[model samples]
Target: MDQRWEDAVFLHWRIPVPAAAARMPPGVRPDVVDGSAWVGLVGFRMHRIRLGAAVPLPWLGSFPEINVRLYSREPDGTRGVVFLSLDAPRLAVVLGARAAGLPYVWSQCRAVGPGRSDPGVGYDVRRRGGRTTSAFAVRPDPTVRADDELSVELTARFGLHSRFAGRTVHVPVSHEAWTLHPATVTHVVDGLVAAAGIDVEGPPASVLYSSGVRTRIGRPRTVRGT
Candidate 1:
């Protein structure tokens, strides 16, 4: 797969190791960083999504996406992300991803006010059943760069762990180093994370933004034992 993840907003909170690990697939555990586990609420626009090196699909290719994700690593040190939920507007995309074992939910997702210069970038996601939603905004400070350990750990995943058929699989993703900007949560009301079975209180612990990046998603390989 080929795609551009644009106008990305990442919000994370430190959680208990057990809390992050509880939803992981077989043979994978919560990847600990800074002495604890962490979960992320990542909202981004997936622009010009194409399969392999092909041209981007027409309208179905571009859409807004929100993910509730956790860090994971196998015992042999293959690190990846574990997505508890992925909300997007495209029904085709949702069905395809779910068929491949990803937890993608069909939803109506869009930007709150991307063109304006005031509140910066944001996304609003409402799932199909109208039971789950996330509306949030942020202001990216271009002057400051977020190069700390937690930010890198949360944003630099190169693959994902998912369950397909009767086995766990690892889907590799490759992208350049993210150009992350220090961002402040101007306003937010989120429930996508909680809907996936984790509880996060107050504001996010780490907030970062990026213009975007192009990516290559690789083949899915079974995790050998599991």
Candidate 2:
């Protein structure tokens, strides 16, 4: 069995509807040129949710706008879609994050495995520079459990030239009973960031770190038992 983890930090920000529309790259059209617009544009998908009750008349697909769906997560933890976005990736992450109240940027963490059947866990954090982002898996560590408590630490700095040092974000798993795949972790991390409402437009400038471990679980028996 094996485990894997990965972390990445990116710059992010929110722009007002008009400014955001003006900043839209070539061949891009915003659902609304005014008012509150939840924009999530990444490699995976772009979702633009309009904030109004007036529905468009039929035959307006090429007009570059669509009715936004209202989604919500209840206080009891039940989830439902209150609205919909044409952008699937944005729908999955940005709106989801808004409903969850999780921070959107600075860093992201993801953990997967035990196997395909296991539910993967992902997290995001906001931190100052100098914090280390980390992902790791260990075998025979019974102290870990799926859905274990996760946390983010924020440090303050003061100075004209104060720069951040990468912070470590910890992702803990229940058991190292399965292999960890880095790509899987990356996908989840990206989704979490998108959900946080970071407009990741244009090409992504990403740096990747890859690592893994292999261990022999057992050796063949030298002789038959009596």
Candidate 3:
């Protein structure tokens, strides 16, 4: 049995739409770009255990993508964190951008801590386009373990100019939880697209699957209207 209790940490960051478009790696596919044309930042941390090692290793990476839509409904102008899988880095970026109300090309600072103590690693996102954007730091949260599962927490501190200013929401989001893996991520994203009333072809309207404890939602349907 793979005794590795891996934890994936994700942070949401916001930036301007034009800046986000600029960050696109040339030839941005049409399907990847949402009609809304929003942009946001997503930071990912993959925590895994090295073979025969006592401690878990962390790999850091980030991607910028457009946010299509959010699942939960909140009061107008109310801020809250939405949990999502790390499978689609680009999707996460887009979602974050939409949530922050900024353009796509913006980048943000990221930091990783050294164990449970010490300040942690810090860095800022600089606009490569001759514009001087302010920098900020993020603090890492302690690790919490529950039986075979473990989770880590963190908070992102953005500059005052950030779109998320005056509103800070922290949510505990888990990525690709075991059995849910890649298939689960696909199912959820597809469901979201359908629920938004977007027209998509093929696939049934509902799907059912067992994941250890109980059956969960895994349906894919074609939307009638775009």
Best by TM-score, which number?
Answer: 1
Q: Write the per-residue lDDT of candidate 1 for residues 119-170, one digit (tens) a residue.
A: 4899998887889888998999888889988789889999999999989999
Q: Rank the candidates by lDDT, best first.
A: 1, 3, 2
Tell me the tens digit of each residue's lDDT in model 3 across 40-126: 122323223232334333332233221222222123322222222112333344465456544344333233332356433222333
* Decreasing TM-score order of the candidates: 1, 3, 2
Q: Write down the lDDT of every candidate, Cα atoms only.
A: 0.90, 0.25, 0.26
Per residue, candidate 2 scores C-alpha lDDT tens digits across 1-226 of 1212222121122345554444322222233212333332211111222222233322211111111122122232322222222222122444544443322233332333334454332232322252533232222222332221110100000100100122111111121322222222233223333443335454322221122212221211111111
Lowest lDDT block of 10, candidate 1: 111-120
Cα lDDT for residue 14, candidate 1: 89
TM-score, prediction 2: 0.19
TM-score (C-alpha, index-matched) for candidate 3: 0.25
Q: Give the per-residue Cα lDDT of candidate 2 at 147.
A: 28
Better of 1 and 2 by lDDT: 1
Identify the superior model by TM-score, candidate 1 or candidate 2.
1
